[model samples]
Target: MKHVKIAGGLGFIGFHLAQKLLDEGWLVTAVDSLENRSELKLALEMELGRNAHFTFLQTKIEQVDFGDADVVVYAADNENRAALEAVLRKCQPDCLFVFLSTTDVYEYSGEWRVQPVTEYGKAMLAQEENIRVTCAETGGAAVIIRLPTVYGLHQPYHLKLGRQFVSYEDETGKTESMHDLLYIDDVTSALAAAMAIDSGQHTIHLGSGTSNPFERTGKSNGLDYQKAHELLGFFPRTSLAEGIKKYQLAHEEWQRQKKLAAMYDETKSMAAKHPNTNQ
Candidate 1:
């Protein structure tokens, strides 16, 4: 089985990708700092822990040994640039390094430029440059996937927004803002396809290939996904309605679980406070 090391495997995209790889019968080593938004970490651990092919390591990328990995997926944020570079140095000569980049590196017109608008974009651009240079010097195969706003089940912010919108409409009768969303499954599929290809160096942009005016106020327009389609055979398969329905179902289930856990904790606390009262 192919051994893959996922940096930030506890993150949103990272966790999903790791699960997909594990399900596909690949041996997956999940290296995470456990520092990212960790609300779903326990849930993810509970779910993925059942797989015999999965392993979780709570540590920084720089501290791990990448010599045994066939593929290294960098799913962590730009803050781990130093650690990322360290991993690159220690990675096996034949290992494929995949970087999860963002569309923030491009201009509003969806054109690649040297300069980025936001600070986050600037950092991501720098991270991408570092990966490109390191891979070039080491003769390592690399793939950079620039992703758009990804949405799906267990996505914290978007799910919160959906719940807020429903409550807002019920209370104040006003509609909340929508987002230009690409389902998480589509992004995972694209990443998997990118990993399967043996082509040397590639930078691919991933999106729904169409602008949604209702979402993000038209900021999702002009992204060119031709390279992704032609090279990786990736295309968004989920429609907005279908994606939203799936997300809603998953969100409801998650909420139910959350409430049940909270109630269980409350009951335990109460029982501890009145140990002898129960006859």
Candidate 2:
């Protein structure tokens, strides 16, 4: 069985990708610190734990034993740079190092802006360079993926809705910005396809490839994935309307679960206080 190690394995994208691989009968080791703790995080952890093929390691990135791993997918954004570099150095020649980088690697401008990297972009660029250099020297492979704004089930932010935030209060700052919107499943599929390529190096930009308004003022346009399609042999299958509908359904279910958990906790608290009075 192919072994894939995923950093930030409990995150929105990471969790979904791990689930996909696990379902496809791959052995997955998910490393996460759980620093960004949330109900969804815990729920995803529990869900992935149930799979016998999945291994959850609540630890730092550098500490993971990348022993015999066929693929390494770094899905985490905020990690110690030195530690990440050290991890890259540890990758063996046969390992395929996959980095989930952001389009933020470019200057702040339109959706496809290039050159003059931002601070975060510089950091990602450095990591990509590290992956490439390390792999080139060791005869390993590396796939650096630049992603746009991604949303789906377990989505923490509602970038397009503008009406509500998924995991934050409505009073939060305006999320109105132009971006290339992508569904989570499409991303996972692209990442999976990237895993198939085990030689040389590649950098792929995955997105709708259009600077659509971030707010849901009107119908989000259909995607044109010709770039990803021609290159990766995959294109986004979910339409914006369909993706939004799925998110809405999942959010409603999450809210219901949250309420039930709160009610259960309240009942337990009451029972604890009245324990001695019960006949």
Candidate 3:
């Protein structure tokens, strides 16, 4: 069982990916700040318990000691500098480093002459030099997955993915935003596949293919979602409807937890005022 280290494994994408790896018989080491206790993570911990071959360290990537892991998934970021620094420090001389970058970098914005990506895409444009320098110095093979807006069962509320549903009549409808919503499961599966590939193809677009380009309706971008089957060999198994249902459930659970916390706080305050209340 090859060990793979995910730097921000406590995050939405990383958390799901970690579970996928566990199912696939890989020894997984997940490192993250776990800034707040995530219900999904707690649930996973309970479900997987001692049987899962996993190690979760509650700390940032830069703080952890990267023991000799076969691959390093550089999922953590503290702006550009800290991001590159973590990679350089954690990567073994011959390790494969996979970076989860964004497709957002490709947009120059506006409805003008947009360029197709070459030598990996525009996502790496800003931090390209730093990435190259760090990888070169470490003698590590660096792979980059330029991904789009990922949505799935556990989509975090903090992503601010605009309003969930927008009607055509609504002036501020999300349909106008025109973004590709990549399923989280697809993202996780793609990374696991990339890790398995024994090739030098270090850069690949982990998207739902051109058929599912950023669009409100299929006609908006002249994209036919059906093409994902042929081109990317990827069809989102979970539809937006199913994914949103789960997301809504997570949101409701979070609200419930919040209310419980408030109620407990009030009870504690009352108890303090009446010291003999327990007696």
Candidate 4:
């Protein structure tokens, strides 16, 4: 039985990966500061029963123990510097560490942009280096999985650059920006493969393939998800269109639920106020 500790295991990508590992009979320890614990728990129950081969740590990554883990999958993104150090300190001396980094490390948000990951992949690069140094000193190995834009079910944001406030070179539909959209399943598969690799301190780029293009006007042009295929021996099976459709469906359901709740609340309040008049 392979012991794997996943940080941020309750997140959008993390939960799916946990499900995959559970299916494969891996002993999985999943940790997350679940922002939506109730919904996530319900989803997990639907996917992997109450007594599955998975353990949930409902706390921050810094608070957990990774000492017994054979492989540690570090997936959290925000405030990650300290979290990385904590994982290194607690991981077993020989445990293989897998760092799930963003393709934002290689992001090209125009030449004049000053964002940290965009202007320079410094912060992410620093994280990669820190892990490399830690592993080298401890005789442990580390692998970096650089993922591009990931989308799938339970997606929180709509595919609108307006939400991101990106100033595209040409706002018209004629100009299209390249976004290497990788489905969540593909990201998980790459993570799984990295866990099995013995190659020391290697960095691999992961996407659906080369680069899946997304038009500013919501049209998708599929790219060969072959880079992952050639390098990691895996390709994303989910199509970008299909993934977008799922996200839209989930979003619509969520909106409907909210509207229904509001309607129920309004009816209950009216009933409470006019009980005597009705009687």
Candidate 5:
């Protein structure tokens, strides 16, 4: 079996990717710091822990040993360029390095360019360059996936604009926006396909390939899956309506769990203070 190591296996995207790879019969080592806002970490741990082919490591990317991994996936949120370069240098020459980048690197023209409008975009661009230079020096293979806004169950609230459409309260206060979106499953499939293909230092853009204007009231324009279909032989199977419904259900469950945990803690505190009264 091929050995895969994910740097941010506990994160929203990383966790989903790791699960997909494990289901495909690959031995996966998930290295994560467990320092994210999502409350699904425990759920992920319980699920992946049952798999014999999965291993979860709670640590930074620079501290792990990647000598035996056939592929190293950089999915962490950290933007430390030096740490990423060091990790790539330590990997075996045959190991393929896959970096998850963002479409923010492009301007409004829809063309891939080096100019980024935000700090986050600039950081991602720098990291992409680091991977390219490192692979060039080590004579290794690398693939950079530039993705648009990705959304599904357990997705971070900040990354998905659909969160605003889930409720009528309008948390973001924005009525509508035109953006490209891709389902989590489609993104994972694209990543798997990249692993199977023997592409040498290539950059691929992943998106629904259509500019859809979404309103805060859960309505959207049409979707176009031409680019992803032609390139990866894959297209998003989940409709926007279904995806949003699933996301809303998951968010409700998460909130319920959080309340239960708080109540349990409060009961314990009361019991400790009234020991004599109970006797």
Candidate 6:
């Protein structure tokens, strides 16, 4: 079985990619510090723990034991940058290093505004260069996959509209430029395909090549997937409407769970404060 180690293995993209690889019969090891822990992260940890082929290493990326691995997927976008070169240096000579990058390299944010690339955009560009140069030196294959805002279950709230759509129940926001958000599964599917490539360095774009108009007006970036299609045979299968419906159902279920958790907490508090109630 091919061995793969995922940095930020418990993160949104990291967790999904790790889960998919594990299910495909790869031996997966997850490297995470859990420094930025969340309810979703905890839940993901539990689900991954159930898989005997999975190993969760609670440590920083630089400290991870790459261990004769066939692949190293850098899925943690907000990890320690100072250790990145060091971490890449430790990879097995033949390991294929896959870096899950963002369109931030070109666009400002998920807003699709490309006017002046933000500082974050600059950083992503630098990181991509680092991967390219470092991997070239080590003679290991590398793939940098640039993705737009990705949304599905357990999506983060800061970068994109998906989490806000779910948590705030606000999808009616207006903007001039259209934002093309890829579903989490679509992005993961593209990444999974990278493992099949025997060798070479590549940078792949995995979303509509244009800035969509506001509110998912069905205007695409012209539905261009030329490079990704050629390289990974990648095409997104989920429509925006379908993805939104999934988010809506997830939101309703989350609300129900929140209420149940609150009620349980209240009951415990009441019982604890009034010991006689227990009798």
lDDT of 4 by residue, 75-102 (tens): 7653368888988889877788888765
After superposition, candidate 3 runs with Cα above 4 Å error: 37-50, 78-80, 108-124, 158-178, 198-201, 210-214, 217-279
In Å, residue 254's CA in model 6 sits off its true spot by: 6.3
Superposed model 6: Cα runs more than 4 Å off:
107-116, 158-179, 209-223, 250-279
Task: Estimate the TM-score of every prediction.
Answer: 0.82, 0.80, 0.67, 0.71, 0.77, 0.78
- Candidate that would win on TM-score: 1
Q: Arrange candidates, best lDDT first.
A: 1, 2, 6, 5, 4, 3
Q: Which candidate is the best by lDDT?
A: 1
Candidate 3's TM-score reads 0.67
Single out the weakest 10-residue window by summed lDDT for candidate 3: 169-178
Which lDDT tens digits does candidate 5 get at residues 71-107? 9888886477876877798888889888888766665
For 45-76, candidate 3 gives per-residue lDDT tens digits of 54445546988888766777675788778766
Between prediction 3 and prediction 6, the one with superior TM-score is: 6
Worst 10 residues of 5 by lDDT: 168-177
Residue 8 lDDT in candidate 1: 81
Per-candidate Cα lDDT values, in order, are: 0.76, 0.75, 0.61, 0.67, 0.73, 0.74
Q: What lDDT is reached at residue 66 by model 5?
A: 89
lDDT by residue for model 6 (35-131), tens: 8877778768877999999999988777777856899888774434767776789887788988876665554333334332556556677788888
Candidate 1 regions with alpha-carbon error over 4 angstroms: 36-39, 109-115, 159-180, 213-222, 257-279
**Clashes by residue pair, model 1:** none
